[model samples]
Target chain A: MKTWIEKQKALIDFTLASLARRKIKNLGLLLVYTLIVFLLASVMLFTHALRKEAGKVLENSPEVIVQRLVAGRHDLIPPGYLEKIGRIRGVQKKEGRLWGYYYDGVLKANYTFMVPQPDALMAVESGKIAVGATMARMRGLVPGNTISFRSYSGKLFSFEVSSVLPNKSELVSADLVLLSEADFRAFFELPPGYYNDIVLSVANPLEVRNIATKLSTLLPDSRPILREEVLRTYESIFNWREGIVLVLLSGAILAFAIFAWEKASGLSAEEKREIGILKAIGWETGDVIKMKFWEGALVSLAAFLLGYIAAYLHVFRFSSWLFEPVLKGWAVLYPRFELTPEVDGFQVATLFLFTVFPYAVATIVPIWRAAITDPDAVMRG
Target chain B: MIEVSEVRKAFNQGRHNEYWALKGISLTIEAKKVTALCGPSGSGKTTLLTIIGCLARPTSGRVRLKERDISGLPERFLTDIRRSTFGFVFQQFNLIKGLSALDNVMLPAYPLGGDWRALRARAESLLDSLGLAHRREARVEWLSGGEQQRVAIARALVNDPEVLIADEPTANLDTALSKEFLAILEALAEQGRTVLLTSHDPLVVEAAVIDSVIDMRDGQIVGIR
Candidate 1:
């Protein structure tokens, strides 16, 4: 056992020296290989981070949202639907939500306006507002700055920026403006007893679907969106987008794979001679295969580490700007946020198994085929 | 000592291009002596050397090393026997190009599964004896043909095998370097190691140290002198 380990170590040492001897060609292959890994890993890490971020915010979301539908389109929910939903079993808490999209013609961007709850982090007075970090950045508004937006009825309303949400909440609160209920209603021209939706929390989490079904039967026009369903929808959306991008990027990966396969499978005349010489000098077929295995392993492992680390830094530090449009959302105004750095061992292992294993296999076949040939024949050539 | 009996090798068997590289031939290689297989190109000198060297298996018949039949053995067993019993030198001086001479010398020891330090020591000793101690760190690609040949010889001897098989060992060397290489082979043979070599050059085949010369024609032994 000790000798086997020593032999492997010696072989690996020889492989490293061999790689260094062809430093230029090997390094070029390493750089390109690393780039491929980086791109794929960045997409994976960015999507994972987005899902995790969405999950964190979703943990605080209401268990169910009841929205009134008119002619299959979302309409304002009457305040009376709250009473009907409150009577359902397992109902814990119910709140009327007042929110609407506010488009600023001046900035040519859309901002989401919502009524602030009494216990909200930011207190908004009638003539003042609290904006999200991204919103403040885009509008160039700081605390105490007056920003004006024309309401849906053409009434211009101006409010002092009271505060900006912190960066930690940027994903959820980006492009959000919080104001008093009266101000929000007036700005959106919503009548009394009408709200965007009714958010409900259930005392028994497992009975949320049952309560939703009861609400649907009681109020046929109301649509109840379960929190679980919302989460699954978000999960599928990100996964679908990732799949599409991966499919598109598969062409590039395939091209590189072909290049790598050709590079690995087609031994140069010098390399063939080297193998022949090694075999001639009392090295077995197994020994030659083992050496080639080390060669393949060293190249792939190095590429994986370099590519994965670069992807981590790219996604976590730079917020995956390269893939933000495809991953974060297809919107003109994207949320300015950074992904949390967290390593998924399974994903990393899967990537290694998928990326490096195939290359190793591809490399071994050619080496094995060559190794089994008559060394005398190869040496003569 | 090595013995070959009724050995035959056919290439591309049963096909239109089927050709026999070696016919039923027999020979005995004595220990502690230098023997030469002399023939021109297409005369099967190299093929017979390769068969005796265990680099290629004979199509039929048996080869014995000290009375052990190695002809019908599996490839793995044949490989083990080859590793422990024989070392080889090729006509082209097939040294791995990117590696230093020392590295090439140490290549065979890598698979023997021993401490690298011990392997390095053995390789150094061999290189020292070959008068290549100063050029140990030089890559074979930058070495002269004679230097490369020395490296190849050192690599073949590093394992300390019982038999050393050289296929056209002096093919790429000048007359002077060829004499130097033959002198090394003679010294190795004097040290009680069996030395078997192939050469068409009269300078090598007619060396004073050679104990016998086996001449071949058409893959069969034509004469022994």
Candidate 2:
């Protein structure tokens, strides 16, 4: 076993030297290979991190959101709607949520206006408000600054910025403005006992689905959306976007594979002579194959590491600047938050299978052909 | 001693380019002596040398080492015999370019890996003996033809095999280098090594150190001296 290890080390050393000899050609190949890996890895890392961030944003959300439907369209819950949901089993608490989208003509962006939940981190005074970090940045608001916007009812209201929402939850709260219930109802001219939706908090996770089903059955015109379903939708959306980007880059992947295949299969005259010399010196067919294997492995592993590190930095550090537009979808005021640095082992394994393993296999048959040829014939040629 | 009996080798058998390089060749080489196969191009001397070296297989007949037939052995066994029992020097030297002389000399022993320090010592000692101690670290391409030839010889001897097979060892050498190569072989032979070589060089055939010379034409032996 020691001898075998020594032999492999010797081969790796020789392979490195050999690769360095043709530095120009090999480096060009490496550049292209790294680019391919970087492209694929960036998409995977970005989407995965986005999924994780979305899950984190929804972590404390109500277990079920019941939206009333009228004429097959989402409509505001009318009076007595909360009473109608009075006694659902497994529901710890049920509350009405008031929220709506406000189109700010000045910024040409839509902001979500909502009354703060009871457990919100910051409480708003009757005439004050708390805007998200992104919203504050766009409007250049500080704690003492006041901003005014015209409501749909042709009424103007000014509110002081109590605090900027935390950056940690920026993905979901980027365009949020939390105001007191009096300010909200006055701005929207909403009458008493009406809400955009009803949120139910269930202590038992298994009971969330049961309560949702009961809500849907009891209130025929209501839609009970579970947190799991929301999470699944988020996952599918990211996956779909990732798939689209990958499909768009399929040509590049194919070209790189062909390039890898071509480079591996085409042994130059000098290379052939080198193998002939090795065999003539009593190096066995297995030994030659082993050397070639080391060569491919070193190249593949280097490219993989370099590419993955680059992609990780691109996604988590630089915000994946190259692919942000396509992956983030169309939005006027998008979040610029850092994805938590994390690596999925299964993803890395899958990437290895797609990139390194195939290239290693590609080199075997060609090297074996050269190895098995008699040294006499090769020298004579 | 090495023995060859009725060995025949054909390339691309039954094809349009079919050609036999050796035919019914039978010869015996005594241990601890220098023997030469003298023939013109296409005379099959190199072909017969390869068959004996275990580098190529014979289409028919048998080659025996120490009276043990190796004709039907598996490739792995044949490779083992080649590494342990035979070393080869080609006409072109065949030293891998871009490697130092010491590295080229150390190439043969890499497969039978054991005590690399000892192997490096042996290779260095061989180069030192051949008056190349200063050139050991120089790349093979930078070395002169005679220096390259010595490096190839060092590589062939690195494993300390019993028989040394040279296919036209002097084909690419000047007269002085060729004579120097012959003297090296004679010294190796005196050290109880069998020197098997193929060449058409008159100086090699007439060398005083050579014990016997076999002449061949059209893939058949024509004379023995």
Candidate 3:
């Protein structure tokens, strides 16, 4: 056992020296390999973080949202809707939600205006508003500043900025404005006794679907949306986008595989002679294979580490600008949030399977073929 | 002793370019003596040397090492035999580029892996014996043709094999270096190790230290002296 370990150590020593001998060529291959890994890993890590954020944000959402439909389109729920929902058996809390999208013609962006639920992440007092971090940054407004927005009825309403939401919640609140329910109704010129939707929070997850079904039967004109279904929809959308990008990137991966295969099989005359000489001097086919394996392993492992670290920094630090337009979609009022640094073992292992495994196979197959041939024939050539 | 009986070797068998390199050749190589196979380029001298050294297997007939048939052995066993029993010196020396003389000498002993420190010591001793102690850490590409040849010789001898097989030992050397190489061969033979060599160079074919000469043409033995 000791001798076997020693043998492998010697092979690794020789392999390192051999790689250094062709330093430029090997380094070029490493650079291209690292780039390929960086591209794929960035897409993967970004998508994974976005998905995790979505699930976490939705974690606090009501299990069921009941929206009144007028001619199959979402309409405002009438005043008596919450009374009609009226304490479903499994529901822990029930309330009406008020929210609407307001297009700011000046900034050419949309802001989500909503009434604070009181159990909201941050408090908003009556007649005053709390703007999200991005909104404050864009408008240069501080807590004491007053901002005005024209109503749909062409009337201007001004309110004091009570607070600016922190950046940590930017993904969910990037273009958000939290005002009192009365202000939200007045800004949209909406009358009293109307809510955008009705929300029911159920303590038991298993009872959510049952409650949703009961609500549908009770309110035939309303559509019930379950939180899990919304989460699944977002999950599928991100996965579909990620899959499309991966398919498009497969061409690059294939090119890299071909490059690796060509590099491994197309031995330079000097390299061929080296193999022949090693074999002739009493090194066996197995020994030669072991040495080549070390060469492949060392190069691939280094590429993986460099690429993954680069991708992590690219996505989390620099916001993965290279892939944002595609992976995260286009937005005028984009989140501009930093992704939390985390690695999914399964995803990384899968990436390893995609990258290093193929390279090692490409490197070993040709070397094994060469090693099995007669040393005399190869040397003579 | 090594024995070759009716051994034949072919290249690209069953193909259009198929050509037999050796034809029904038979000979005996005595222990602790220097023997040379002399022939022109197309002759079977090198092919026979490769076959007897276990670097290539014959297509027909048999070869015996100490009365044990080795012709039909598998490549795994043949490699083992080559590693344990024979050392090879090629025409170009074939010292791996970018490696020091000591590293080249240590290549054959790497698989054995007895003790790395002891192996390094032995490799150093072999290089010193070949008058390459001062050049032990020099990369092979930096060495002269004669120095490279000696490194190859030291590499071959590092495993301490009993049979030394050198193919065209002086093919790449000038006259003086060729003579120096021949003197080294004579000295190794005098150390009670069997030395087998192949060369068409007259300087090697007619060397005084060569105990026997087998002349060949067209893959068949033409004369023996």
Report iRMS (Å) of candidate 3: 1.5
lDDT of 3 by residue, A1-381 (tens): 999999998899889989999998899888888888888899989999989987887888888999999999999999887987885688888888899998888779889899988687677877799988877888888999999898889999999999998887788787998999888888897889999998888989999888988898989999999988889998998898899888988898778867766765566778877888888888898999999999999998999999999999999999989867666633467767888887899999999998898888878887888888788764364
Q: What is the DockQ of each candidate?
A: 0.73, 0.65, 0.70
Residue range B1-225, candidate 3, lDDT tens digits: 999999999989999999999989999999998999998998988889889999899999899999999999998899899989999898878888888889899999887767888999999999898899999999999999999999999999988999999889898999999999988988897798899999889998888999999999999999998
lDDT of each: 0.85, 0.87, 0.88
Query: Which stretches of model 1 miss by more than 4 angstroms?
Result: A84-86, A329-331
Candidate chain B TM-scores, in order: 0.98, 0.98, 0.98
DockQ of 1: 0.73
Q: Tell me model 3's lDDT, rounded to 2 decimals.
A: 0.88
Chain A TM-score, candidate 3? Answer: 0.94
Error of 1 at A212 (Å): 1.8
Q: List the candidates ranked by TM-score, beginning with the highest.
A: 2, 1, 3
Strongest candidate by lDDT: 3
lDDT (tens digit, per residue) of candidate 1 on A273-366: 7787777777788999999899988998999999999999999998887877777743445788887886778888888888899889988998
Docking class of 1: medium
lDDT of 2 by residue, A110-186 (tens): 99999987776677888898988778898898888889989898889988888888888778888999999889999
> Candidate 2 lDDT, tens digit per residue, B1-225?
888999898999999999988888998999888899998999999888888888788999999989999987877888899889988888888888888999888888888767778888999999998889999999999999999989988888999999988888888899999989988977897798888899899999999988999999989989999
